[model samples]
Target: MGTSLLILGVALWAGAHFFKRLAPEKRAEIGEAGKGAVAIALLISIVLMVIGYRMAEPVWLWIAPFWMVHVNNLLLFIAFYLFAVSGLKTNLHRRIRHPQLSGFKAWAVGHLLVVGTVQGLILFGGLLAWAVVSVIVINRANRDWARPPEAPMWKEGVAVVGALFLMLVVGQIHGWIGPWPFGGA
Candidate 1:
């Protein structure tokens, strides 16, 4: 049942996200209420995912080497930085077409490294696939790529600072939820 819920949640997350890109006509037919409906579905999906993952029993697959901890941390840091770049519209945005999804992929990979269970594989792998497909779907929908003007250098600096701040805050939340991310407390 837990596994089923997890699958449903992941599927809903992907479906809800894709609905806008895939079915613009139907979405428009719903008028403004469609946005609210999607938001509600996304929220329910998050709740389902959280409940499902916790309810699912662990089925460990592999034990990560101690060294992978460092790799995971590095990837998470890069993920955070990429998220900041997306929001800040830093110079990196000009090069990376989809910083947000790329960061999401990185985040999923980082979690996959640490979590070696079947549920982890399903959860992270599903999200990773969704992120990858989302990029493709979006790129197909919008062919013309108009790169935004690079933000000022100070914005990049702010992104760096924001990355650091985000890392600390998210790391704290991560630790609270599961293993301590800093040193595996």
Candidate 2:
């Protein structure tokens, strides 16, 4: 069940983004399709999250040390911070051209560390692998790409601070939205 949902989530997410490259014209014409794809991806992603979380109960498929969990938690925290900071008009995104992708990699790696099931490994670990590849591909492709306007210093400062602030709030309420079965409690 978890594997199925994970596959679906990956399909939806990958399919949605992958089409942009294959059918750029169609993608432009059917703006709604992109939105639809994203919406469906999000919905399926939620379902996948639920399944993964439910299966991630205290029961261990294999022995995982408590120290590993601590490390996983730290990685997850960094992942969240990366995701948040990438959203702002910061140097990260401009410099990398794919801050979100980088963040996704971090987030996936963090989760993979915590969850050792094959299904969990396939889902998060697979995504992390993809992110790494995509980052390299995008970087190579855009090595000579044109640059966008630079953001002001004030905006950069605000983005960094705002990212930190958002992390705090998200951490406080993480259990509510996080897929971890034990997150909220």
Candidate 3:
């Protein structure tokens, strides 16, 4: 049942996201209302995914070494940093076309490395695939990309600091919900 719910959530989430790309005419016809509907579906899918993942029985596929946790942390840092840079006017933003999606890909891959359970694989793998496809589709859709103005160095420093703060907060939340990221420290 949990697995089924998870699968359904993934399908709904992916479908809603891809709907615009798949049916641009339909999306345009719906207009702003379509965005709201998609947002609602995305919210519901997130809730379902969380509940389904927690409810699902763990079936270990492989054992990840303890060292992988460190690597996961590093990836997470990079992910968060990218996410922070995405919102800001940074020079990195000009170089990385899809900062948020790239962050998401990194995050999903990091989680997949640390979590080897069946549910983990299904959830993280699905997200990773979605992020990859999104990047590809978006790139294809926008062939001639215009470069944005570069931000100041100070702003980049601020983004890094903000990302670090966000990471700490996320680590705390992870500790509250599941295993502590820093080995229960």
Candidate 4:
């Protein structure tokens, strides 16, 4: 059940984002629902993540190389930093229009490499796969989209500060929530 839910969540997240590109009209219709549909989808995804994480049993399906952990952590950190940069209303947003998606892709792949639970594998692996494909498709499709060649220093500073704030939040969650759906203190 938990595995199924996690898969469903992955499907929802991936499908929602992808459909926006594949079927612009349909995506617009859903988007016209005034953010409610988006919010609902996000809510469902969160619930699925929580339930799936909680119900997942820690079983080693495959052994990751020792160096992979450090690499993955670094990737996750970079992902978080990109997400922070994307969230800020800085020139970074102008320079990197899809920083959030890029960040999520990195974060998902990093987790998939280290976290070997069924739910984690399904959710993160599915997302990582989608992210890769989406990047390719979006790049090809939106090649004509204009972009800024460079960002201002203030934007870079905002990205740095935002990353630090987000790092603090992640630490707090790790400490208070006790390692999320998986019991790891």
Q: Could you list the CA RMSD of all candidates, in the order they appear? A: 1.0, 3.9, 1.0, 3.4
What does candidate 4's lDDT look like per residue over 32-94, in tens digits?
683677677878887886787677666567766666767776786788789877766457667
Candidate 2 global TM-score = 0.71
Model 2: which residue pairs collide? none
Please report the candidate that would top lDDT against the real structure: 1
Which regions of candidate 1 deviate over 4 angstroms?
none
Question: Weakest 10 consecutive residues, lDDT, candidate 2?
Answer: 176-185
The lDDT-based order of candidates, best leading, equals 1, 3, 4, 2
Across 21-111, the per-residue lDDT of candidate 2 in tens digits comes to 5567888988876778767767777677567646643334555565665566666555655665566555555666666786677678767
Model 1 lDDT tens row, 87-125: 989999999999999999999999899889988998999
- Selected candidate, larger TM-score, 1 vs 2: 1
Residue 157 miss distance in model 1 (angstroms): 1.4
Estimate, for each residue in 48-103, the C-alpha lDDT of model 3 and write its tens digit.
Answer: 89888988999999988988998888889899999989888689999998899999
Between which residue pairs do clashes occur in model 1?
none
Please give me the total number of clashing residue pairs in predicted model 2: 0
Ten contiguous residues with the weakest lDDT in model 4: 176-185
